[model samples]
Target: MTQGLSTPRLAALASAPPRPAPPPGEAVERCELCAEPVRDGHRHLLDLEEGEPLCACGACAVLFDGQAAGGRHYRLVPDRRRELAGFHLDGPLWAGLGVPVDLAFFSVSGTGEVTARYPSPAGALHAAVHAASWRRLAEVNPVLAELRPDVEALVVHRARGAAEHWILPIDDCFRLTALLREHWTGFTGGEAVWRHIDAFFTELKRPGRPPRR
Candidate 1:
């Protein structure tokens, strides 16, 4: 199915995959749900009511993978980053969306509202997104139809002569935002920040295909 990109999608970024194993002096972060010992590569859970991701151990993440028994509580954020090579978008369409940044994320909220956000030195910044534009894109992309409500997102990037798109877990979106926050400098993000962002998309387009949807 064809995918389209224009502006940010609604959903908060996630608890980043922890950095590489810590040194002996640093403390490790344990699972907030079960207090189980967790490694840096552990997964995350989306707290629907809170609209944030909680670090979770493997067992707890799996146990709550499905919908909560009482009501919508935690939704396990799946880890998949698919390159949408067939995405559709053009100058006029993108201009209509009106996102201020080159890279942004889109997700659906618990209330089924579509939202958009972009990375910034101050962290991710939210902006107004016309729902009609989003609906039009979804109408064209069957893969985007696969985005799990509140847990997955459509990330669109346009900069430095590159056009990249992905269907990624919400957590990865936050990780991207954090990377920008830590590296951004000067008005146009300088050379260092662009370098990192370039390398990031380079890897995203690397040989390894994301797991089948």
Candidate 2:
């Protein structure tokens, strides 16, 4: 009877959703936009309408820099990565957002609407935030008020009585989401996932000039 009971549990586990794939190998390649050969360090552009990321040579990325171009299809992903020092969200404010996860990314959409997404065991889970909440957040950090629509995000992670906030490119947000979906295990993401998260933050916190406030 023990073996019979275990068989059903195994079958249920087999039907669960698959995890996100690991990060791809890093090698120089052609630009997705101009087809010009680009190095692994080439800049990226975000196709706002389609919500797709495009690898681009520097020249191609420059072409889409100005938002006033009015095409509404493509937006250049800004390279500015910033750490918001002394950022805090009280418990009541956190509860208002309704995100169960401790990490989340917030970005403005093509239509000038702010949205928040958190990584989950299944995939990126989006939670619609009220406009008033966004306004309040902007009041605290005006830099966040200037986040490029669809192409950039303000990522915040609150855990263990500490919080870290970064203004990051949208693609990086997706990368983190992929990481969580792949290696997360049990309630606390297991050992492997925590290691990966730590390494990622180390890169973000490297010694360099902070982004302009």
Candidate 3:
């Protein structure tokens, strides 16, 4: 006769960890709020209460398009991208921002706090910037005044004495941070990571499609 499996072993098996979800490209993404299937490039809503981005269906996203929409709980993140061709940022002003990396994104919170976030091998690291500096930058670049707080970001990239500036959606900044976090290797980030970085900027230079309703 065969012996029965022990109760402890059965209990342990019942508590086994769940399998990991499929990769981003392979997974079918659903809206976090309504569970509607969203396409790969779906719009996102920022959960102001939770301080995190939420995947949202087209209907849910439109409900929170305005700043005061959704009762202050969620804010629709815009999908605009504008290259600041004439923006000025000298070394001194850049240094005053206090970002340690060549690439960083700046955003103002609802509470008027200014922050600069740069990517590292571990993840995104945050740094504080003086309000005066931000104000000075905004004075020079009037377009910066148009950025919607908590939804848009000023992304800066300085490499080999070349400077590039763009007003991008907050999610775009998050995507860049995620890319660096995933591809970075060793102290210099290796050639493969740089190639990916180059590709990212190249794509950004192209035109963006209109937002989906």
Candidate 4:
């Protein structure tokens, strides 16, 4: 006679944690609302119901600026980008959040759950984070309190071994995703990709805010 495994143990072994659906890649590239042709450099609006970043031409984007009226169905992603000066985070704090990568962006989704995503060759690789850990960090960095739900994120990078944080629009986060996907090579991202990444952050650090043209 052989002993059988317990039901709870068997059930636990059978189940695997679910992955967040990698957001729709290359969504329409053009304004989804008015069918206007959006340029490569364009703004985006969060399609609240669908939970996807919808491409929007300047005109259409302006319509939903701040908050979308009439039930808040859509919210325009702003152009704001600010480096979080003297942002604080240590190895233990970051590891406790449970993100597999050293560099990841944290944001809240439309339905109000925190999302931990990192740029990778595959895309923005989504991972589950410990909510309690995030709460602890938010207490230390009050700036986290200002993060806009869904359309904005707190992007942190320790790529060079020095932690850098930024409050950037969600669209910019996707741009980083696209950059990594296109230039990344096997295992470690190639030197070319690293240079590109450096340049991207350099531009972000450039003085003077981008004018609202």
Candidate 5:
């Protein structure tokens, strides 16, 4: 007798369509210094003490745009992406740098120390840059003298019998490192990783400034 009124309700409940899940809320990226939401292409600052990058809103980025703006603790990462024309790095010279990998980035630290890093599956592998070799390389490439310490890097691409050189923001170099860490596979890095690498280089060349000879 009690089930009489519930029969239709039970059938209706069973026949009702399942409700859809609510769409995920997009995560908003915020400036590390001011806690303000930043746009997709916001500026970045380098933490000199920790050698890490921090996203910044427009106003915060302008504050540290100068060399002495943040009291030497933070440096604004520039958006320059330059392809170096007539850049020279001979085979013997590359070998002297002591980086086992063909792809690597070289940067000068705040204290005038130069370090060479190459992306590996284990992360970025560091190599000692012989002082003499670096000096010779910099001597030929005068543009290197303009490289702002801790913000820019001399990125070399020599993999797959290709020789390409670019002066990119430190953030770009780190992005390449992350890309390789995510896609690299096996001893030869597989075909997929190479495709990504090619695409990355293409993007860099597309809007890049006229080659600095």
Candidate 6:
């Protein structure tokens, strides 16, 4: 017959490696401040100088929300989503931007420069955007003129002879890029990506009256 194990031996056996914890839900997709490991609904901040996306938690995001901070490197990403229905762009001007696709997003870079980019098979591709043209576009839509440099973007979609514009957060632009990169198929991005894109735009709320030209 086997003897019973002592209390100390049982205690030692219980100290073996514990089971690994399961991954977090959608909210834990990436950290909003560091882009590390945050929940899907995690907050985010803007890197002003680098124009980079930062993953942050609620506390970290709150730290940079006040004017006394002098608006340093980090700024909390705002949740304002508005659609600019009256915004207009002619075909020639759109062609001049050189974006391969009809859909593109423009934002001020970390260096205090404006840039326009679009999703492609390879990744997000930058287009050559003349400042004068941007100014012209901004004339009709002054809300776009107020876009927080680097952290906000002006998204434009032109297809089937119609165009739509929206002022969105930079993180939203990244989300769109990530979606296209994952679901894109064929040269036109196929139906799956189109459906996803449609759903995203549908949620945007229209802005107030268009600003004077």
Task: Identify the leading candidate in terms of TM-score.
Answer: 5
Ranked by TM-score, the better of candidates 4 and 5 is 5
- Tens digit per residue, CA lDDT, model 6, 47-72: 66665556676666667665334266
lDDT of 4 by residue, 41-144 (tens): 57878766765567789988777775544146888887889789978788788888876666778888656678787755444467656678888888889999
Error of 1 at 158 (Å): 0.8
Residue pair clashes in candidate 2: none
For all candidates, what are the clash counts? 8, 0, 0, 0, 0, 17
The RMSD (Cα, Å) of candidate 3 is 11.6
Task: Arrange candidates, best TM-score first.
Answer: 5, 3, 1, 2, 4, 6
- Please report, as a residue range, the 10-residue window in candidate 6 with the lowest summed lDDT: 1-10
User: lDDT for every model?
Assistant: 0.70, 0.68, 0.74, 0.70, 0.76, 0.64
Give the poorly placed runs of model 5, Cα more than 4 Å off. Answer: 1-27, 208-213
Which structure is stronger by lDDT: 3 or 6? 3
Q: Top model by lDDT, which number?
A: 5
The TM-score that candidate 5 achieves is 0.82
lDDT of 2 at 128: 72
Each model's TM-score, in the order given?
Answer: 0.79, 0.78, 0.81, 0.75, 0.82, 0.71
Could you tell me the lDDT of residue 143 within candidate 5?
89
lDDT of 1 by residue, 48-76 (tens): 77666788888887787675531587888
Quote the lDDT for 144 in model 5.
89
Query: Model 2 over residues 95-195: C-alpha lDDT tens digits?
Result: 76667778888888867677788756554467677778777767766787677778888888875443778888876776676666667787667878767
- What is the Cα-based lDDT of residue 51 in candidate 6? 52
